[model samples]
Target: MIQKLSNGFKEIMIETIDKLKSSDKRIALAKIAKTYGDGGQTAVAETFHVSRDTIRKGSYELESGFPITDAFQARGRKKVEKGHLPHLLEDIQAIVDGQSQTDPSFNTTQLYTRMTIQEVRDQLVLQKGYQDADLPTNQTLNTKLHQLGYHLKKVQKTKPVKKIEETDAIFENLHATHEAYQGESNAVRLSFDTKDRVKIGPFSRGGKSRVRVEAADHDFGQTFLSLFGILDMSNEHVELTFTASKVTADLIADQIEAYVHKLRSQQEVDTLIINADNGPENNSRRTQFMKRMIEFAATYDIKVILAYYPPYHSKYNPIERVWAVLEQHWNGALLNTQEMVLGFAESMTWKKKHPSVTLEENTYETGKKVEKNVMDQYEKMIDRAKGIGKWFVEIHPHQCKAALYMGLKTQ
Candidate 1:
């Protein structure tokens, strides 16, 4: 019966490893090593036909409390195209030359070829008069094609339906505003956006580490956390706030309120220019968020200029880059608790400076739309750009609401 059970376990291991991706297979095998103890490494190695050293390394990773998912990374031999395939790149490029999109308007030089590696091989063998022995296998040919910058990519789902005529003009305006704000001593320029949502519990994330760490078996939706971040353009300083509750308009407004208040304590900020994309929670049409912003400008007695980037271009916002750096900082480590997540974020450096992290435990109500009557009063304080109103706005203090129209620069 014991022998039968051991055989069943080996079958299960084989089946499980077959179903998993490369990194995940290592993690699963690591877990099994941990459970079996002393001879666990040997048992797993024999069952899986992997070297004992690989299993022993996994076991060590499990004990060390780091991540070992990428332990076997770059383990295989270099691709043939890198060294062995002398004429492969030139030959493949010639075949796909006609498919190149030479249009200057297109962002990239996209190839339109749909031929498979086998077809390519046949073409080289028959037309190019190369012997079958001289040609590499189809798999190697495919890798060679990729090394030559060819890919079998699917079309993007969200193609721009129509070009916004004023997109370039808006970007030009943003550049001018940023430069103008930077020139002033008492003025501030900031980029605002929400970072990638993270699950609060221990979960396996993509990255490589020297040791392996165990995470939760499954990811549940309820444990996710949203982070709203603001990047100070002048000093390269970042501020982060964590919200277990959904990222709502009111929440964004509150964070802005807190940020402006903190700035007021440091210096007498005259003009505040903020750059952000038109996200759902803080768009120009988001009355609640705008209402709070207008109130914030008025209370701070500063002129607030909201410079929005074009749709589907969140990368233009400087805050997005900050999030990328933070993600890399804690990619492999297991963020098991709220404190762990906050600690990791606080520890990440941008321009040799770490950000101040604040946890917003206060839950705000979602889908809270402002009343039309209240919004109408607030609208008078906001002046949007002509033809590109969604991409730009100026909010004046309550008392100086008429300032919205005074120097409205639509250029």
Candidate 2:
């Protein structure tokens, strides 16, 4: 068999293997190796530039008289991180969550990262203890960051606002303070807002469907439900809760409590940066809301920062983007039933992932407010930002402790 192979014939065999597909090429190489018998593996390996193990695999398949496949080849290439480092995502999340900055103008939800791609690359090596050789390239890291719902923005987006401030002081304050809380592994940043109520009735919301001016009430009569959406801004995590009662200060606090519990299970949460609009219920002076938050801080031993967007700027809140997507998703769908409403909401995807959805039937009174003296006690616990106190508020756990303790006894 060795004598049968001439110099030209060997060249021809190599050419033939090059032209054939992978499986065919492998089998052909195996056949060529069989001609050499003993030194066959080495000859095929060196000549074909493939491993001896590959030649052995080809030989085994030939003997088995069936087609075989290399699992790695069949699966194709995986994402850079998944193929090389399984922990890449968690590491990147830690890095970005530490470095995330919200847009002051509040136009986009993407984290305005302080670190460039190269810096993040260095952090992986310096901070995460990853070897440079083991890490993906900077470009790959950028792609991964994009996949993780983060991107760096150079310009601030400003709308023809109602001009809330002359020097952009309010916007600047939000940018500065919100950026401050980012990048702490122990801190969780969330963007939350309540979507407009949707009415569920026997009506398709198409162009001209309602023939009767007004119909008799159905079982689910005049059903209007409001949805509270929260986005974990550092990542693509979302939680959506639907409430049948009015969106109240108490309801807002209740949702926060629930979300915090869920987040605590995932990580050690020390500080919460909650980005919300200046809604009537959870505004800085909402006594019940502040009081509940104070209690929440004390119970969980966490600092809560209340970041409210400027007036009439609720559209800029990050969670509003989710509502926009949902509006488009459920626009034409027949939402005449509660099941349909929830089904549409659950089926819709924000950032390519569905949110955890729940329906809360408990009725929370809207006008509930802590008494002035009681609220003054709560206010003592709150640290309102100097100029924009109504928009940006901070409540420390220790302050909450002191305030709650002081309020425990009547003077």
Global lDDT scores for all candidate models: 0.76, 0.80
lDDT of 2 by residue, 289-347 (tens): 88788899998999998877787667778888888788888766667778889998899
Cα distance off (Å), candidate 1, residue 250 = 1.8
Please tell me which predicted candidate would have the highest TM-score against the true structure: 1
lDDT of 1 at 293: 79
Error of 1 at 405 (Å): 18
lDDT tens digits, residues 1-411, model 1? 212468777677588786976546666677876777777767777777777776666656666766555656478876555655666678778876665433334676645456777778887777667787877788878877766666664444455635477878888888887877676868888899987689877777876667878767787746777999988886777889998888888888787778878887987787888899888998889877887777678667888899999866677888988888888899889888888999999999999999989989999988877788667766766788887788889876754445443543210
> Lowest-lDDT window of 10 residues in candidate 1?
402-411
Per-model TM values vs. the true structure? 0.58, 0.56
Q: Cα lDDT for residue 165, model 2? A: 72
